[model samples]
Target: MSPSDQVLGTSVEAGGATGGDWVLHPDRALPAEPGVRALAREILSAVSDLPIVSMHGHVPVEWFVENGSFGNPAELLVVPDHYLVRMLVSQGATPAELGVPTRTGSGVTAEADPREIWRRFCAGWHLFRGTPTRFWMETELVDIFGVTQRPSAETADAIYDRIQAVVDSPDFRPRALLDTFGIEVVSTTDPAWSDLAQHHRLAAEGLGDRVLPTFRPDAVLTLTSPTWIADVARLGEAAGVDTGSYAGYLEALRLQRERFKAAGARATDHGLATTDTTPLSDAEATRLYADALAGRVTPEGSTAFAGHMMFQMAAMAAEDHLVMQIHPGVLRDHDPAIAAAYGPDKGYDIPLAIEFAHGLRPLLNAFGHHPGFRAIAFTIDEDTYSRELAPLAGVYPGLKLGAPWWFLDAPDAMRRYREAVTETAGFFNTTGFVDDTRAFCSIPARHDLARRIDAGYLARLVTEHRLDLDEAVDTATYLAYRGPLEAYAELAS
Candidate 1:
């Protein structure tokens, strides 16, 4: 028997192979009914070739700047992927076993061998059954890397060898892969204190506006963090301003945003456990800032300060024309032990219930009608779709509901999102879709899944006599391509 046959545990056959070899059905995520499936196929075909406008994501800028080969399959696909690492950890796999890097002086040694990590992941592949992770991984394996065999203990070594060869090829370089993936513009989330050296390097190479940076100021804004003082200092140095006073700190943040905008940034991202945007009087703000700088800030002070900063961020967005992207209600590092051992993003962050109507009213009241200001709000809380978020987006001219994201970026959840928001908020009041991934290779797969789910939803709408076939195709095209472009129109400027 051939090695491929032995590894896949099946004999090769004509037309299509069976048994252990991985096969992605052409109708994978579509509606199962014949009539709806046919309509979905037509709708999907119309917009499937649109270039991906990944306006919000976590792919590192260094990947594009360096233009080097991926180290190995495990590093590219396993270690940095929280979606995969979280599932493996839940199924009795250790982060160290999966080669997740630990913090400095954490004394926890990660498994150093890439092959061993790959073996551990392959053995636990069943844990991802019926998950979005599995769907994305399968697409990456079969479509991107041309792997025909299923991942299992028996096939792990063979699959890894094949993937390693592909990673070593010059075509696998990050810049080359952008063309392969059809990404028109991809944004990297950068800290408030970033000097944007990597971004300048890429821009100087004439890759202007293709790769953009996003302003993320969570560390400097959170007064309760242990490193907040140092982070404030870094922000001051990066912005060439003093941060010793509250007024100076605000100016520093404004200057940083201006720097990001000059470097091709179109948005600022804020992640919080709550959605509070209450503004404070200048006196109160100065007092909190002084307390924070003196290391005497209370828990109440921190919460108040963060909410005030949210209000300030929105005001800044209005003046600067940078679209604001807010994704809140996530309690980071639920497991303290894992966080201490393996730092953050090992998938311990869990979602909490958030109230958007009351928490965001102050900010909306201040600038929701301003033509220059625009905000996209995302939530894992499905309950808010039709209740709070949809109604708010329906009325507020400056606000648009973000697509299903993070934990809610699955097939059923994506369909549910449309059902909940399309009534009140409608299609134009929403941003099409944001991949929001650090897993660079999975961007196309994630976008494809969203497109298929949306087509299926639009197909059902057509069959229900709500929308005509032509209208469905138009809406599908808008959701896939035009929505992002319109929402982030400043990018074109």
Candidate 2:
């Protein structure tokens, strides 16, 4: 066996032996103790095949509307995935070598061939060891593409050819794969100013019920954003309401919410640097809006106005019945050079320490008890899970704890999340698993991992005599399918 084979635990010859048999263990992520593992297996068996309800994600809607075949393994698995790009770049790989397109209109050079990119990825596959990205990619390769080899330099060409052939088939098209993956409902995030043309196309093609759009208005709320003026103007055009004044801007947002409702959107998503929700008085907010429109808003003014917008968004959600989803604490575009060259979502986003209890106090006090309002709060700060968010969601009728998000979406973190939140907020107050990914193929794998982790968590509860076996099974079903459905109930209705 060659050194590559030694790294991959497979036999390889100079003539390229077809890797090894990589089996996805039945209890891949379950507890190692026999009793707990057995119980986990039982719980997992009950919910493993449950249909996915992905209520919040960043998947491009055009893929489903177009129903086109994927181009290559690298495009399908690497270039578009920030998780992979970030890891590879951390290991001294450049975006250009990985076929990542530049935002400056210069296309990826010929040297960034798909085959070469796959080889680079294979060479660096060891870097993802013990990471959720590794698990997701392994599942996609072995389960979805039926690849029998571990990714390595020697097996890169063979694995790429195998995946390429699979993607070339009609069965691998986006719509077909949706059915194959048993995805019941998937939501794609769209800007408030979006036309949702692809969403409309999906509806026309009878797929609207399965694939839906989510309203994300962050760009318009950031008063100091480079494109804030343009985004607000676009919102005005889309809603047919003048947005020159703060009152008209609020009205434009309301109209856009109604438009989204008509287009089957059931939720509005907010990505904030802070979860602050201090509402400014009407006159104060109007002044800030005018300053922003004139490109004269200060940093302090921007922060104050953005917080005010979050409060106003909750009020609108209460009236419009759009479930509010807040994922705060991310400092996006951490590296300005990378962002300027490769564009946002090239994976420089980093998490900040967040204090959600006081940060969310104003909004919760204002609308927490509203009958029409529903909110799901997600965080990368584990400290907030038990100390702040869970306690808040435990009491607030409108607030639900969103699943472990972004950096916390790994197996151990998820397990910790259930342990921390379930004690205070309980299962029902928590929204179910959300595969918040743009990597479409990883959706099933991510959801599958969540289910297994939840099962393991519940299995330990059963072992502790805290839950009956039948009750645990039922809860597993809810966490896998019903929780998200109930959280976004308006969409189903």
Candidate 3:
């Protein structure tokens, strides 16, 4: 039998005043005024347990199939998470020592011990303080994993042992865990070169017909990133076109779209520094491709190649039934040393001031009016929510605004997102929350936060009589399930 924790622990010595498990008392979550809090609580209860519809996220499919005991608590929770790693790195910890993967075919995993990593991570728990990562980890440890005593160096061994014990059971496996979390569907990201054999295997084994893939061919379009030539060649082979030429390269991309479609891909994802899209004519495109092939493209030409490819992708979506997702404004791997030691996502990517107006013009102009084309744009720049994103989605027929992403994916962020987008674009113009995380176990936590925020927001609406309780219930359900299913259904199966 698996170890199960059933207590909401509080320790005066450790002081629960910290944000993690301390952010909200179940009762305190209601509101300041008793009557208002009660109403809010009632509203929140309506959507608390809706089945999760994860339209976007990142978790290895092997977790569901060969679900083994997660090696260690830190490996399960901290090491792979940049949200955790970046914070740790900020405190002078080195990624090399934290088992961060290396790009030069070497990895820090060699000399690292899981317990040592957890000890290091635990010592830095105080750094989390009021941050959302602190709150979520605290909740996961206390509320979910049954770790009552705050994680300090003293508690590392006990905590890891307990968590490992709990996870060793059949109940802790991926399918079982998803069941425990009431997940109905989960969409993972895959590159265009991916064969998706694992996804097919899981679907064949009957993982409740929920697990699926999203086609993310950023490596194909991101000429600035590594593996560009290989990615392009694979694109050509998949599409049965010559990738050596600009025209053939476009065909290769189109063919990969069909391949992903056949593999149950419902959407395509792109990671960019900005939402600004540039389109190039045939002549300009040919020149850029030639430069890229020759490894002589200037930085400006490289970025333009990405922008031009965005337009071409939109055109491909017009023909195929795939939804398009663009995750923009992240300056990936800002730390030179950490990036040198560890590859992409070694906890140094920072968000930038992403402008939607000028950045997205080229692609939007090309397909903004074309019916049957859907583009969902995501941004970490909260400043653009009401001012740029809401207004753009409000007017564009083919564009649907994605929710606040990455750093802005917390409960407060979700609430702020609704307040930001709903007034102008309205709820229908916005796709519901996508977890957008690589932490598999945290998917439930992310979605739960979104629902709680939505419920809390809708509860405010109901209390104000701006929305009826019945309507709030329906909307909550939609935000949790129907919205994602409708948004990504055709692309999946």
Candidate 4:
């Protein structure tokens, strides 16, 4: 809190003995069962340094194209990390102190040392204990930056200075780090109406082979979006199609999908309250479109239109090679005030009870058997993993279960998912891990956790002899890296 503590290069006493070189004893957190430990170690070694294929995330396009230095630690780490702020908020740490961008709030760093903000973060580091947050933070701190000491109130300033120095170095730029981190491919979610100019630039410069784009039409499809009708109209304009008719809307979507493909997008993403794969007749769809344009569409009508659109989008994907991904079961931005101020994805999104049994039947009925169609379904509803999702994916040629995500993106969640469905759906029936993050630095950390957790999960199977040790190691490595490339084939070569 004072300049007197500003010993930038000075050594400070770390509170914990496991500070220096504490690179998260990977797979050490799993349950201790006979033969489990040895098999886990084998699986971990197999996937220790495999390349990451991130098929879904919210990475800034400009970070790669612009390749500019992130200004400070708070800006790079705390400001964009929803997981960090979400945990911080739970522990009575305000966003203002953590340097979160908010509605006209005064952030810490009035003195602008950057180290002070990090010190504050370190002081509250205990709040993340027993959480995936702690796992990820420690991994990032040690593995990525080679920090020898655990972040604490005492060593916060010292570590901050070291990180600041590392951050400003040329090796820490987005593209450079992507290469260093062994990121084979990274994809970002973009609106269907987006120009994707940066993606074009990256492609033109050969960076497109790694930094890719995914079409996220959540805004255009969600009837709850304030500018739904306007968005549809703009979608029409962007796609060079007419907007006055229901047929024209479908045409617009097709054209936009083409445009996205041309702009280096090989995947389409939908985020909805549920996989409400309902069907609507042409007349009903036309009526809904008209009402939406007139701002007279009922909530029921909006839901119908969204459900209808899912089927329609699948139809498009059937014709194109674009992989369609469904992210269902989130009650997005539960905080009305936060929604009003910062909009969606401000760390207030909550998961709700969702049904996958009958909810996806209509869409599955329409598109599931099509050889040309592909859909990767993700759910917060773990109850469905074995009961519904596994059976469906096992049978449906086009369907693949997406990785455990959002609320269930933790280590336990990953292990539980593999245990629940891998027996029935098997490894090939499920798409592998996706970062699904807004934070850039956490990409490697997230992937590392998924890998280690998967290694540990497979180790149990190998120990039980449910799977051969060699195959378990291979599958674990695939889940960490290769499976993503296969699921997102067009994006990753």
lDDT for 220 (candidate 3): 78
lDDT of 4 at 95: 55
TM-score of 2: 0.94
Q: Tens digit of lDDT per residue, candidate 3, span 387-441?
A: 9889999999888888778888766677788998899998878877777778776
- Tell me the lDDT of candidate 2: 0.88
Better of 1 and 4 by TM-score: 1
Give TM-scores for every candidate, taking all chains together and pairing residue i with residue i: 0.96, 0.94, 0.90, 0.91
Of 1 and 2, the candidate ranking higher by lDDT? 1
- Residue 139, model 3: Cα distance from true site in angstroms: 2.7
* Alpha-carbon shift of residue 226 in model 2 (angstroms): 0.7
Candidate 2 residues lying further than 4 Å off, grouped into runs, are 1-19, 105-111, 491-493
Best by lDDT: 1
Q: Sort by TM-score, best first: what order?
A: 1, 2, 4, 3
Query: Lowest lDDT 10-mer window, candidate 3?
Result: 1-10
Q: Tell me the whole-model lDDT of each prediction, alpha carbons only.
A: 0.90, 0.88, 0.75, 0.78
Cα shift from native, residue 1, model 1 (Å): 28
Rank all candidate structures by their lDDT, best first, as comma-separated numbers. Answer: 1, 2, 4, 3
Hey, what RMSD does candidate 3 come out at?
4.0
lDDT of 1 by residue, 448-479 (tens): 99999999999999999999999999999889
Clashes of 3: 5
Badly placed stretches (over 4 Å) of model 1 are: 1-20, 491-493
